[model samples]
Target: MANKKVHTSALLEKAGIPPPESISSSVVNEIQQFRKVQPTSKELVDGILNGNVTALSRAITLIESTNATHVEKANEVINACLPYANKSVRIGITGVPGVGKSTFIEAFGKYLTGLGKKVAVLAVDPSSTISHGSILGDKTRMEELVKDKNAYIRPSASGETLGGVARKTRETITLCEAAGFDTIIIETVGVGQSETAVHSMVDFFLLLKISGAGDELQGIKRGIMEMADAIVINKADGDNIKKANLAKTEFNRALHLFPAKKSGWIPTVSTCSAITKEGIEEVWKTILKFLEVTKENNYFFEKRKVQNLFWMMETINEQLKLNFYNDPEIQKLLDSTKKAVTTDEISPFAAAQLLLKKHFKK
Candidate 1:
């Protein structure tokens, strides 16, 4: 019987199966080692300041973490990086679905990198509402730019964020700037309130549109047109060239009706072909000119200051809400309070007041 047991053990070892006890011990050891070796905030900040991409990615992960334990470290890393950030020209790009945003970004990013500029592309992909799953497929679409040593692309899931931007996008931009990216492009999930969110973070907001659609302005919100710094009619190749030109004319006319932007710059309309790479340089030059004009007039710096203030208030609001919702007392009362409201046993306002009173008691 002992020989038979020994033979069975040998066969199990030969089959590459670990003993149950050993398997459990190995997993515990790995978890312990992982926790032990996690980088400190100082180490992450140092790595990012030295232009380490790995450190940048890790820091971003920390920022995106939902774990309460990571919040302190994430904030420390962000504060350290803040002194070195805001050096890049942040640009926001948005367009409706089927407008070829990925293709345009590939060509545009490659062009910027070719000019010896370090470019970082932050793409927000829509998340599945039901499962919270996201494709995060921008890297696959921007194949050529992905290979460029000077370019970095990050695709983030827009989980429940109203604007289709990752919750930590602003923090990620700061990390990228600390890592020496000269240009940061935030490509928002197809047009919506997301455009407004992107506009808040970027120095320039570019709106890309397509041609030959039945109505030139169909499906595009008028508010979006007003927010754009420049509108580019894309896919200006082959038979589409004429339609693109006409769209540009129509957009130019439409833009004239909106109030002038605070920066004293008139938004321009142009045409481009992402595949053929035509007019890409023209669009870039327009951005540079806008920057120059804004910088000369000091609006550029003023706008950034305003943005910083906006984010500071935004962060405080978010933290307050988090604390309110995550409080143990509040959590315990929430289900009953909600049920009371549903059953019409309590007025919604009265229920909210009661919850607030309970929350403040301790």
Candidate 2:
């Protein structure tokens, strides 16, 4: 037994180790300095106005947070930044899945930055319903723009918002504007109905299309085409250039059939090759012309006022629905009400009325 103990000691010595008698002083110091201090609303506002990207990112995170505790502070930050907002040219871009949206955006954004414009791109990615997660891949796709000092790219999850945008997208735009971005581009998940949501918040709506895609307009909805301020047929390089021109002609003809827009500016159609960076300048010129005409006719400010009113009403409606659904009594009743409806024990309308009454009474 003594020899065995001696052998174990020898092995321990060869293994080269001993327990620490005390924690190192540097480790102790690190532990003492680890407390995180949250920035106040004023600080966040100041940083955003000063064009601090870190502050801008934190402010956006606060705005997007679902926590009730962050609501007051987020509102304070937004209110503080409101005076600096609304100066940027907001544009919305939408297209079907395979239309090379990221490629086009990178090229277009680089062009804007080249013209000494500070550009912000807000790309919304669709979330998986089951996992409630999204693959925010805009940064990966927009490699060149990601490195541009004058460009900022943010990818947000759609989070069950039916319109292919994040719920806080408008607020994000405001923050970007406050951060001195001269141009703001909202990129939506390439799905139908998202176009309407994008159209409501942006001064100009651009629809990106490609050629040799089935019926040329197969997947696009008529309402979306009507909403577009401009439609650009992308991939107009090399062999596909002819096909793109043909698509542009057909689109222009289709657009003429629609009634005149309230803005009094005729919608334009153009073809561009995002890969070769051709015709981008023409597209930007078209946008500038639309802005000039709209501002002259007083439609620019008028549209913004109407949109603000619409958003206010939308917020109220959303809050009311949230309050109704989040009530404990309503949640308990909803489970049974669904079964009752399925079993023919109660009509859907009657169940809804019951739930509403309970919600209001409580």
Candidate 3:
């Protein structure tokens, strides 16, 4: 009876059965030795400086964490890593969904790794609107690069907004640079204004394209063209090679219409076959040439300085918005204020002022 199943209605059998123990002493003892303790910020900093990938990943996770407890620790790690950052070349890549971005990135990353460069790729994966979950399939797609000892790929979700992901990525770049990665490739989700956000954070912006039918120039955004340091026409292999060259010529003609860049660097058009790995070396050579030019004129250094200032102001704006919405007084009155504004009982500006006053009073 003790080993057999007993129904609750059978009181005699049920009461006769002994209760389970409160804690499994043997299981607890076995688990205790393997428990992971959170490393300190100093430990993370030292590990990152010593080229430890595990510590670098943990530091990035702390930066992306929404918990309040992680904020201070994250800040400490960043501050410690700041001196070691900015030694790498930060490149941003974006393109339409079918343009073979992953293929090109993997090929490019492998080429860089072959050149003895430690590369870190931060690929932004699209999140489902309904479930808010990301595919994070970059590692799977870039099988060769994923296995390379000189390369590290981290795929992140484009969460509710691009600003959050951009900020996290920017910080991640610093951590990667500190961890001995000399080349940082940031891959955008290739939707909406993600390209603009990524462009602002990177030193070089690459717009990947593929030759298509007779509409090579259709639906291309003028702003994106202006931002490109180079437009790489990918999939230039087999029968597509001719069309790729034609597309390149058309793009170069279109690029000539844009005003000269402040950096005085002419944007180049190149064709590459990610599958065949043809013309991949030209892209790296072009980047090196750009670095030589930009460094000669000091534009590279000045641009980075300006970017740091812009991010400082951006961070201030983000903090102000977060604090205003998270305030206790504002939280209490937010619903009423929003309702009043929606129903025309109060002006939006006036309701905002009231909330600000209430929040400030506290």
Candidate 4:
């Protein structure tokens, strides 16, 4: 039975972690045991000190957990890993389906490994089924890179609710850093508006595109363009080469339509083909340049610090809401408030205030 205790479970149980009470200890023990033999958080911390891939993946899983009890242990792991994390640049990549995101990642991941840097890929696939799992197949798409001992690939699980990113991803990134990865790449699925969640979390946001004859930008979401640190027109080889060049020129023009970000970082447009491995180095170089410029101007570190603050705020807010609403008495009060609103006895805003006051007092 001791073998069944996952670090997450053991840590949570040890910490008296808060989660849905319905979640059985048996389930926690099962997940914990499975992690024990694999490259787990504990192992990864060891590996990261030595730079191991298996350990990195396990650590990512811990960070991605939605279990409330896991939160504390997750934080502990992140704190322990903090000093080792963040040395690697964090980049967020997104695109619609068929934009060659997985392919490009394989190429990009391979390229970074070739340069003697340790690479960790955390992909948020929102469309995965409840039972089957991540369909993007990071390991298969990047078969070559998967074999490299320096690389770690984690596809998002099927049922995660927080915009495809498992709740603990932000924490996971820290663990990856602690484990000594030099470059952390966050890949988001093709969920249109939801991509912003990833954008707000990463240092650099890259939007991948396909070859469009000047018309694609019109179809692109303004919100995504606004958040992108760079726009990459992929599939630049073969027949699409000409179209890709035109698309790049068009995006360059489109980017000028917007003003600079509050941080004063101007997003750039580039092109690459994962099949040929062309322009991959330039993509990596541009990211470094973006970091260099932002860090020099204090935007890099400040932005991440702000993100951490935001993460804390959101986590606290959600936890408070869960704790409040999950109570039977509070739920009854909320139902009564709604009834009052329908009868015009109390405005919604006032009812909310009253409910909060009552909930806290009780």
Candidate 5:
């Protein structure tokens, strides 16, 4: 009578009934059939060069993959597409949350496509810091533009600072340009470091503004205002028009306070209603004028060259950090090292040196 044997399996069922495999088998077959054909790097390159959006999307998905196995294939695709890139006009757009960026972009993209410009939009959706999940809803918001044969919209989740917003962005743009998009619109998740990241990747930067929302410049970051090539006051139709105009004037004055841009292009403030499509055309005109001036002064090409250099350096930094963290030995020590620093067992600097020393000892 010392002890009795306990049977946990009896708490449920003696033999669990398996879910119907017959139903799932057909679905699995269909999925396998769909995934059966993954095009080669040369095929993807040829398709992208011929303006194939399917190939372009697949290539971008590969670039975004976190799996190390996909890296080589993604790089091959990017290298193949590079020669056709750097030819498109890169525009970076940013605004605060609830600033109507999606509507404005839809209208602006439609206007661009109407003028026979092949447009590609890389829209970054906000991701949660805790869960790190992103909502890619730009396609739903941009119904008309999504349907246009000449326009392509690819929505990515902003890992905020995990290098998700910046990594592979250049490659995505290159792939889009290779797919013959004359205009590349990079839409940031919101008004933050994402704007700064996107600003570095594009030739022109646009900051979208809204009116009747406290002081016109209250929440605006000075760095963003400075980076903006243009500030567009959105939702300018009807009763909001007057307020929008007033905000535009304030912004124009604020823009003047900053030092002149190196490209010699004065940033302009304009108003537009995405629903009414008013002033959308003018926004394009402003971009065109910016391009004209930058190109004439050779600033555009020079900026591209500088951006290439920045990206090269950024890639090296990211790769080195990734390699360091991904090293088996570092992975083993990272948690304990952090605990040591937090618990006063080791100073932060000393802890970092310890980790680095251990990592580089090879």
Candidate 6:
């Protein structure tokens, strides 16, 4: 009975009701500090399960950090939040330069939030670097949506190596879901391999294209088109409407030539004008419909379980590689191995095995 009462009380608190003053001061202080700095694994799990937004954001930052010390903590947080993750729809949006990704995202996000949905935008900006401040200029592009209280926008921080994508994006999605965000939007840097990274983490991949005279299809890469579950031709208003219609037909035809995705979801090509806010809702409806079909077919949970395993394997590989390169003794051997290969004293494969044997004690 006591346990049941406690659970009920916590549920009430999570619903935004203030808990009794008898709640432990230590937990309160921990929550406060978690708001200021990154939380420990336990704190993050507790805070997220309790629907604390600050804790979720801090936990995401912890996972994003390349610092070796945070790896174990990040793993713990992910493991704890695993059950709560994958409940939200994960959508990845990518486009080439000047495609109005930010504008479209804002319009789409605001539309969702207006429908009483909690939306989180995990935006990855590849153009920025540590040496120079993140242009962060795109956030400005989302002029109206930035002011919405229900939307959470996180820009890719400086120095992240995976094409401005925070390595912890998968974990971040978990954190957001645990915080009760119903929809999670991952905005990739929209060039080259970044889209691939985004595609791996999302349930649906959306490729944005600009309609140009005789050159609409010319802008997109074939590989990207193959990966997309939906291709949205943006900037579809005003003078481009005719071109946009033509582009949509072109994309619809192009989609037919490729085999269906492994997910068995047919790619849909549509048009939207971020400027005029046309067709934005239709694009969202398509996303929700896809979710419905996948969920009904049991593909949704299966895919998420596979993605979780992929997350663990990728993290382990990254940590092992980091440890190998960061060890001073290993570095010395690696230098010698490189020299041996350069001088033809050892084959590349033999030199690699030799270094592994020396460092791994195998």
Each prediction's TM-score versus the true structure: 0.89, 0.88, 0.87, 0.77, 0.89, 0.80
Stretches of model 2 off by over 4 angstroms after superposition: 1-36
- What's the CA error at residue 319 for candidate 1, in Å? 0.4
lDDT value, residue 272 of candidate 6: 94
Please give the clash total of every predicted structure, in order. Answer: 0, 0, 0, 10, 0, 0
Residues 73-134, candidate 6: write the lDDT tens digits.
88788888878766788998888877888999999999999999889998876644546456
Better of 2 and 3 by lDDT: 2
Regions of model 3 farther than 4 Å from truth: 1-36, 163-165, 191-194
lDDT of 5 at 122: 92
Which of the predicted structures, 5 or 6, would earn the higher TM-score when compared with the native?
5
- For candidate 3, which ten residues in a row score worst on lDDT? 6-15
Which clashing pairs does model 5 show? none
RMSD of model 4, in Å? 13.0
The TM-score leader among the candidates is 5
Model 6 error, position 251 (Å): 0.9
Model 2, residue 85: displacement in angstroms? 0.4
lDDT of 5 at 55: 84
lDDT of 4 by residue, 16-69 (tens): 656666888999999889856644345556765666555656566655654666
Give candidate 4's whole-model lDDT.
Answer: 0.78
| Each model's lDDT | 0.91, 0.90, 0.88, 0.78, 0.87, 0.80
In order of lDDT, best first, we have: 1, 2, 3, 5, 6, 4
In model 1, which range of ten residues has the least summed lDDT? 5-14
lDDT of 5 by residue, 1-362 (tens): 68988767654744577544556777888978867888888988998999888888888999887668778899999988888888889999888989998999999999998899999999887788789897789999999999999999999887645322546788899899888998999888788643587877899999998999898977688988988899999999999999999998898788778998898999999999999999999999999999999999999999988989998998898778878988999999999989999999999999999999998899
Candidate 4: minimum summed lDDT over ten consecutive residues — where? 6-15
Estimate, for each residue in 1-362, the C-alpha lDDT of model 1 and write its tens digit: 36554334434454575566735777898988875788999999999999888888888999998778898899999999989998999999999988999999999999999899999999999999899999999999999999999999999998878775788899999999999999999999988754578888899999999998768976598888998899999999999999999999999888888998999889999999999999999999999999999999999999999998988898897787778898999999999999999999999999999999888788
Model 6 TM-score (2 dp): 0.80
Q: Is candidate 2 or candidate 4 better by TM-score?
A: 2
lDDT of 3: 0.88
lDDT of 2 at 34: 49
